[model samples]
Target: MSRLRFLAVPAAALLLLSACGDDDAGGTTSPATAAPTSPAPDAPGTTDASTGPATVALSDDGTHLVSAEGRSLYLFTSDQGTTSACGSGCLENWPPLVAA
Candidate 1:
């Protein structure tokens, strides 16, 4: 009887230790959590690809553009040409001109 009892005690302890090591992968970020709250600064002379067709504060020849957040300015090389590539889903917070 004592021999059976000793074996049972060790077996129960091993079972208990094996059950304690479960860890799930890191949690995923939701859309709301991943979304950016502020717009990124645009370089001068370079058009904001994310803005709309409405007029932006570019120079007479479109050499520079300002960010909507008013945090920084962006510039584009004269050879780069005018117009921005930012459109569609990229303009959530950085909305383009609205014909005011």
Candidate 2:
């Protein structure tokens, strides 16, 4: 519902924020998790599992992180420290990953 969407935005923002810090000024990105040797699963995730933690899996090439649905993930250079800069029109192209 509307409430979920509202909460999801902040959740997504926090995830984006964690992807960067003062140490990596060179713009290097760390994968949230180790890339699995296995191939990605067939589906994204169950909508009912809202309480579960959102997870990102590795794509087949092992070059980058991907959504459970297999969409390539990205971060904006405009974001500084623990803040997320992508919003509005930006989100239309790069939708944030929500826990549920």
Candidate 3:
């Protein structure tokens, strides 16, 4: 019973590691490929009101938002609404999204 329990732990860990590997190969996506190749249909350069300069794109899981240039958009939890809380030094690392 003790040997079975020890083996079970290793087996579970291996399964988790294998699952993580599949994300990079099968489930994971590069930022370049995630965005649209051409401009969206609504306007010449606009995607939508909510997303602003960003447009929605399809992924393995579902639809997600990306920048006009096809870069992935990430929201900062530290910010309040559309306002940015990050300082200039921090902005160097995480640039704020601005309207074009």
Tens digits of lDDT, candidate 2, 1-100: 9999999999999988887745533343434643332221123332433445557866666677887677987756887664557666566667666543
Q: lDDT values of the candidates?
A: 0.42, 0.59, 0.51
TM-scores for every predicted model: 0.25, 0.44, 0.34
Candidate 3 local lDDT, 1-100, one digit each (tens): 9999999999999999988774443354554323222322232333343453433343545356555454456766876654556676665665433432
Model 3 misplaced regions, further than 4 Å: 1-63
Cα error, residue 94 of model 3, in Å, equals 2.2
Per-residue lDDT of candidate 1, residues 12-99 (tens digit): 9999988886543333222111122233335333455344333334333344443343322333232123355555454454443322
Report how far off residue 6 is in candidate 1 (Å).
2.3
Ranking by lDDT: 2, 3, 1
Worst 10 residues of 1 by lDDT: 28-37
User: Residue-pair clashes per candidate, as listed?
Assistant: 15, 0, 0
